[model samples]
Target: MAPALNVELAAEPRSAARSRRATTEWLASVCGYASSCDIGQDIVLAVNEAVSNGIEHAYADEDGVVTVCGRIEHTAPERRPDGAGPCGAFEVCIEVSDNGRWRPPAADPGHRGRGLMMAEAAVDHLALDKGESGTVVTLRRRLGCPVSAS
Candidate 1:
């Protein structure tokens, strides 16, 4: 089993790069042991998008903090009485959260606002939570599978 990663950084533009580097290193270390470097790369891309969004959109102009956490889990598929195929595997789960409320971006054709969409496309599962205090984005991708599966 790989060790979990948890990091807290300032909600600034520069922190996005820092978060990406840290996440990349951590994922590489974890996936290298499992011989799943491709999955790690995909995770880094998805994480970068989410972290960048948190810094650029969630905090905007105010001071805030972003928390990033990651872990690997093994899940067993639910058994069906009808004898369906089994689907159990290891997966990497990452969560990026910012302590600021979410605001919709203005409708500007020239402006690029597809980070979340890209993240959704890159990962197997993506979830977003927006509340009075903050927003959290969760990304998950299964390991030991082809990139298309993710």
Candidate 2:
């Protein structure tokens, strides 16, 4: 089974930073040596943006909760072209959801509306689902890693 992180917190300004810290620490614990690379930082940044969007846009009328879930999965290793060995790879998936109504952006979004763009830039895949209940932002990235000997 892969390592995972599930955190639910109040939808507030501080929740973004809290999620960032939690994700950073969790990645370090599960990703091992690869956590120091740029992919780790990219994952954290994308997660932070998703959480911040939920807190800022989702709970405009009332109090609500935000949930951040993350997991790392090892994929099938591919043989290198040079026949050196198998090249290991892993995919990290993180979902940030909020239990609040989705609010349409203001007519004139000043220095805003860039959350999705920024998130897309940081990860390999980004998807947003908005429904009557709330909104969910998913970030996924696959990166190469050193293969561990069994």
lDDT of 2 by residue, 1-150 (tens): 445889997988988889988998877776555355787888888998889889888888689999999877677777877998877467888999997887777798898898878989999999989998889999998755652322
Candidate 1: stretches off by over 4 Å: 33-36, 77-88, 145-150
Model 2 RMSD in angstroms: 2.8
Over 35-133, each residue of candidate 1 has an lDDT whose tens digit, in order, gives 336667778888889988888888667898889999887765444456665443567889999888899876883668888988998899999999988
Q: Estimate each model's TM-score.
A: 0.82, 0.86
In candidate 2, what residue range of length 10 has the lowest lDDT sum?
141-150
TM-score of 1: 0.82
Best by lDDT: 2
What overall lDDT, based on C-alpha atoms, would model 2 receive against the true structure? Answer: 0.82
lDDT of 1 at 76: 55
